[model samples]
Target: MTTPPYDGQPQFPPGQPGQYPAGQPGQFQPQGYNPYGQAGQGQGGYGYGYAPPGQLAGWPIRVGASILDSLIISIPPIVGVIVALVIDGDQDELGPGGGIAMVTGFAVGFAVWVWNRLIQQGRTGQSFGKKLTGLRVVHAQSGQLIGLGSNLGREICAQIFNQLCILNVIWPLWDDKQQTWHDKVVNDIVIRL
Candidate 1:
């Protein structure tokens, strides 16, 4: 049979697999066209990148996680209180042993809370509460797991502010970045997983 002329152009140039023509859909655009340059770099004109602005965890979810964490961390103290009540029995005041038990309970609870919230969360980017809530705490700039320092600052400083000032926790509700005061201090963000 006589051969026919192939008049149509090939979909891709020879040897350029997976590459599309300029201005074509699915083609990679140059840097200038990118709305956000790099993952950790600052946004268009805003501050540091620290997780994408839109991907931040909402106030309600964050609050829920906080509540769950509070409950989990309070167990030790609650047990201590029960023990104190048992020891005190009919006495109007807590006995020495009961007082000690209560203090010990609070100390142990604080330690456990710090371990999970500061150390484990810093290393893994999630705590029991965060894991359950499908949220994570990550470095603001890199969006990577936070380090011990950041975790400590976040848990101690930021958390204290949230606890003391109701507005600190509520700030995220109206804040543009959706960050709690603590998040800003540690340069971390609670993001939905």
Candidate 2:
């Protein structure tokens, strides 16, 4: 017996008109096709039944992660300011040593922020808080980790949106993908691991 010739189209029946085949062989499938059963990526095909990596992280957990990260980054600066205040007690102007302490504190805090949020998260897709909370940030369409440059830009946008209004961070509460304004800025999504 001879098998029937197969076109590039899928072995299964075709989907609705104008839609790409379920599992066309390519490194990156079209936006509307999903052979991996991931959310919003596209419909899965019979070709390979791969499980989704994760579900969208909820707003509450994301908020918790944010708070945790804020605390982590705030500690150094707050401690420094406290030390400066102690050193300059009852003095209107800060002493040289007090000023140095305050500056050092702020610098350390900034370094921590950069390491935790920009470098680590950019490389692993999970900041310290996100790792603790079992969440990861990834490209919205590709489900891959974003690079450092994108992470830096995303952080800048996050700061702007956060300063603009509370709604920017709170957007994830009602967003379809549970994405904050910053996540949207970088085309990223937070997923619960």
TM-score of each candidate structure, all chains considered together: 0.72, 0.75
**Model 1 clashing residue pairs (backbone):** 50-140
State the displacement of the C-alpha of residue 140, model 2, in Å, after optimal TM-score superposition: 0.9
Whole-model lDDT values for every prediction:
0.68, 0.74
lDDT of 2 by residue, 13-53 (tens): 33433322445432223243445444444444333221124
Tens-place lDDT digits, model 1, residues 114-142: 88898889888888888899888876555
Backbone clashes under 3 angstroms, per model: 1, 0
**Residue 48, model 1: Cα distance from true site in angstroms:** 9.1
Q: TM-score for model 1?
A: 0.72
Query: Could you tell me how far off, in angstroms, the CA of residue 103 lies in candidate 2 after the best superposition?
Result: 0.9
Off by over 4 Å in 1: 1-54
Worst 10 residues of 1 by lDDT: 1-10
What TM-score, to 2 decimals, does candidate 2 have?
0.75
Runs of candidate 2 exceeding 4 Å displacement:
1-52
